[model samples]
Target: MDLLRVRAARPAATGAVLAAAALLAGPAAVAQGDSTTQSDSTSPGTTQAGSGWNDDAYRGEVEVIPGDDETADMVSGVVFEDADRSSTHDDGEKGVAGVQVSNGRDVVTTDSEGRYELPLEDGMDVFVTQPRGYQVPVDEDNVAQFAYTHMPQGSPELEYGGLEPTGPAPEALNFPLEKDMGAKHPHQSCVIGGDVQTYDEDEVEYARAGAFSDLAARKDYSSCGALFIGDVVGDDLALYDSVRELSGMLNGPARFLPGNHDLDFDAESREHSVDTFRAQLGPQYYSYDVGKLHVVALNSIEYPVGDGYNGALGERQLEWLRRDIAEVPEGRAIVLATHIPLLDFADQGSDVHQVDEVAEIYEILEGREVITVGGHTHSIENLRAGDSLTGWEETFGVEELPFTHLTAGAISGDWFSGEMLEEGYPTAIQRDGGVPGVITLEARGEHLTERFTARGDDGSTQMSLGLNTPAYRDWFAAHEDDAGEAPEFESPLEVPQEDLGEAWLTANFWMGGTGSTVEVSLDGGEPVEAERTQQMQGEGQRVGAEHSDPTAVQQQLVHGGSIADRSMHLWRLDLPEDLASGTHSAEVTATDVHGDEFTDTVEFEVID
Candidate 1:
């Protein structure tokens, strides 16, 4: 009666299967919170996370109808409106007509009676796409329940326990739903947490202290919920329970994904590789609607050979994508969610990491408004429409992006590597010098905008402002061979008058892209435009110390982690060799394409 709360038996994840949790967090003991920083955040809200996290929200059990045979040709199901809040189809529950149901390939809408039948095959998922004004039920951990996986003989013995042998396909798979009063409103906040990728318990705690803290503290994404892009764990699928516990602390519903790290290494074939992940999490790929948007989760990783994975969708999945897009009306925007990017700034030249059939994907939704977000590279990237890469053209025959492609950097930044902050998480600076965080996609009807909240910090801290001197670059060249054990780049913010002309002020804007602007002002003087280092205009990647974020590299070289050798969002401006020498302050303002702006300040000294 309170919505279709499933009491029926559903898929159970085994202790040995790969289990997971979507992650977004804040600093439990934030070092950034203590910094002497002031700002006017580009953030839509004054604070990203509200104080209210509904720990006592409703929970429902998932259901999978019982059946006796594995040879059934078709499966039947009802999309009932649980008006009685009984969680079951009681005598009074009425069927909701016109709902869409799919068995992975073919999509069918329910008749006037709210029931539909589809051809069934082994290794397929039968799910209901929650229609506008209707809400799906969530489980104890706030993971939405709307699909049933059918794997009769289950998986071959995997390193992590694969799905247990589901003896037969069920005769009927009824999907329960409740009407959401708030669904009438077309605005929503959706969180995309990239790679959690926890390796062990300590890293799990690091995740808690970092991204999950940030996520749990936020009340904004309760309706659209949070979808973790992938890389749920680092090789150890055994850490699922620990991660799930962290997900339980989230303020809203949570969804997990599969990445290269979440594979079943011992599986016998390509399709079976992620059976353990699906068993622990939900479907491999599925779709759902929130407000005016239709979100498609894709399993883009193709493992043709043992343990060797590439970013490509199989024919079956691609065909499904075509069928999936056809169902949506032209008025709504489509958000494609995958673990590996359709194409990315981080791996623009690499064929394996970027989606192989990107041009085909672009062709599928030729005229529709499409936005893609993904994880895997572990860096923050905000590549926009018309952004082209020579490698994209050479490798995938894609000349330019048809729509925006946002890379949601990992919650477990740099594999959770680097010095621990006071919040109990590592600085974990990424290859792009962006810190660990989650990307929030705010949507009002079909229009979309996004922002990144770094672990242990607020919205105003979007960019890291600093000065890069010639001495630091020289030290970088000298210590290039020695990381973690290298001597600290001393007095990095101080400048010599002779080197002032060679010094540059840099802003590592985490979410800034081609349409974004970064301006600098000295001692509150008039602002001057700072040049973007690597313009996303069909150019090859510009790498090395000169292109790096000096602030992030200083921490990485002195501590331990991947070097932030290059970036797509970094902007720089050379300082003048002035006549006077004194302590000086520079203010930086970063304005995103949407015209939202954040201003931050950094202080430096010039000695004669």
Candidate 2:
């Protein structure tokens, strides 16, 4: 680790960046015509700071490893410094030592000469896990290119098309890497977002104004960039360009995974299902490194199973996963990013909504510090280890989770449902009462803390509190179909004396999970602990008035959104039946797993 160097802040000029690289940056090259362009004047091949071309992966040439024979049953590769930024491993450019490469089921480290060989199988995807301070090449759309498909035969006849098989095994496959001028270590902000499912251009604009705009305004997370955990676009593959445009707003490198909605449903077979997605995004499953953290993005959506998709990883991918983790150095922090969750509080009742082989995945990650993130549920659920759910137990026989699993709330909250907001977007409250937002994982070495940022709200805003009155419950039943048409529920603070006994104060803590505590107090009195609605301890979803969040339900019922019928992050406290007739204020404080406290207040009246 002593040999590792920290990257610094970039200089304004491209010439300054080249000068700072110790002349490692080769001669200036012609600007490449890409669909998206940066605001900075730096050439695409330059490794200058603030040039917006800081990703080293974008500045290299492709080549084959020097001394390897064809017709070999083993895969050989050389990881080298792309001095010319040409992607090809030129003669003058030397091989980089101590790099980790994988063949989906086995891991090998480049020797002193920066060359490695591993047993190869047909149709296997060979890739190099990028190291810190170095970047792999990225395409015009900023999709990282680190893997090579070695399919001997092109994809079978399918609608979307699978990998065009390479006619024969190459003598050697080489990987190119450029030095990162702005890499950060020890402390990093990684963005984990979910479900930007834009069905049309209108929704694309909504995403632009909503989460994308919010992300664009933030300067943090430039190190690891942003990872969209699947559903980049709707079923229409044509909209991939629009999706790329959305990512263009990001300040750092952008990566994506595939979701059920992102599949080629018209494909004749499963192998060719994600062809268009692969052509647009990067690999279906891959890994990368930042500081001491190793990030693994897995494809969890299995299409053409029968009538619909299933949350599964085919045997090959699973085998690759086993090999990938085996290569990770012991004690390094691992972050797993995927489309469908392994086990989610939102879909604890459905078998098809979560990964089918959670136990196997858990076993692979055993004895390691890990955090898993997914986006299919369109809700925010920060579940920790030891958390158990009925669905997981019945389906995968998972007694308890082995690590933290966070279901990232969607950027297009509830598929862009609800009334339009003044911010040029919809409220789009999610099914679990969480607002549309991006999740931030602040990492300092192997330990990290997770935080949620609502689409337009400040960082401090974490939960919404309101009184669930009898009148509101009646209104919910009557306006089930009146989306964006029903009148707003007025007089939230004025509750009749008759309704005070049954009324409950509801708290919708967006990222709250097990070990979180919510307390309520009236008029600054003694705070009473509020019970969480869904314990997720092998029980069914709790719904109805006692469990539902009134604040989210109000907007969801009348404004067209996923019904807030059950929530894992919702908590309720029954109000006192014998209260003096007067106006009172209830102060609510929610403390998450990290001991971070968020306070909110709501006033209600008890009139005789």
Candidate 3:
């Protein structure tokens, strides 16, 4: 049978009882996708996700499973309304019809009685797709309880405790949802933060002062809430509490997806690797509907692949995705959130950094209004439809992107690596010259307009201005290793006439990409259009002094961080040699595809 045809019979409904909290205001909770064929046996190629510090004793251990009759194992569940706010299905409580439920691979909608059944196998995760107008029950830690794992025999011997033997399938595995009467708005705001990646308490505090604090102050995204996509911790699962404390600052629901660093590398089998993550976070992958948006978050890391990791969706996830998407109505806009990028402008030459099943994933999502947002790269990118990159083209035969793909820049920019700022944080600029920030997707129905909000700054701070003079380039090259102690380049506004011909004005518009424009004006004169360095249309990377953002390069090279040698949003304009020796002021304006303009000015002396 083709992988797409897997289906299971419907099952009965189950329930539990719990006290209901008051109706909450703000955005809906975090929603959390895949490629591969259907198979009864575990595929050898399907590696586990999550990574941690390597230990010699955990090397070369293979995942072992005992074969059993598929017909003997069946999972039955009910999707019911917990009337009186109790999670249990009492005499008067009724089932909710048409609710989709899944045992990972097979997707079935609840009948009028709000009951669904699916084939359950060992080591399978069963979950319900949160429908619009209802809220899933939350645990004490506020983690959603929409999923249940069934492992009859438990995980094989391994380090880092795996799922304990589930004994047998509960006679009634019920999922409870409370009716949420909050009006769904036509316009919804979704906050996206990437790679909080806090390594210790200090970095967690840095995040607190930076992006998290900014999020704490905003109340706009009460519907879609805030989603932190991957790298939640830097290989230190113990700090999950600290990360959760940061999320606690948000006004809306906060949800998370596990990153590479959030794994247990010592587990003997891939099935056991994410035990800690599952114990902390609710589910590895799940989906939810809010307003008109159908959001899907995926686990994109394949750990310990030759002692490292790669971006992929193994057989299980892929099959689940195919089935899941099948239930989605045609033409509904889909948003995918993942840890590793499906495709990105950055790391275009590295195949390992992108999903191995890009083509298949696209095929599954064909003819849909889709946009993918990912973290892990720690850089910002706004790749649009038809965008092409050499790595994607050559590696996956993906000629062009079918829709938008944006890389959400990290909250812990450059791993919290940079000079301490007066604002009580670091100036940890990203490789693409984007400062630490959160990305916002404002949608009216299926139409979305993206906006990036830099940490510790207002929305107006969308671009950076720098004079890319020969002197500045020289300064960048000389102080490559001297972070925090490098002397500031004085009189940066003054430039010798000899340096003018070779010098240029640079603007790094953090969210600018394919359809955006940057123009420079001297002395309030005509604005001369500057050229974008990286067109991102199936080309190799453009790097070095000729294509760098002098402002970010200076700070990164001097203050310890990834060099701003290449960018997808950098624009440059050469200064004319005809200008006489005197003071000159240049005004730069960056206009994004949304017709929004951000302006900045720089003044320099044309020294004789």
- Tell me, by TM-score, which candidate is best: 1
- Model 2: weakest 10-residue lDDT segment is 23-32
Ranking of candidates on lDDT, top first:
1, 2, 3
lDDT of 1: 0.77
Tens digit of per-residue lDDT, candidate 3, span 80-114: 88766556666778889998988878899999999
CA lDDT for candidate 2: 0.75
lDDT of 1 by residue, 461-553 (tens): 677766778888899899877778888777777788999778898888889987889888888788999999999888899998889888778
Question: lDDT values of the candidates?
Answer: 0.77, 0.75, 0.72
- lDDT tens digits, residues 309-349, model 2? 99999888898889888878875788998899988888876
Q: Quote model 1's TM-score.
A: 0.91
What TM-score quantifies how close candidate 2 is to the native fold?
0.86
TM-score of each model, paired residue for residue: 0.91, 0.86, 0.85
* Candidates' RMSD to native: 8.4, 10.8, 13.8
Error of 3 at 317 (Å): 0.7
Q: Give the number of the best model, judged by lDDT.
A: 1
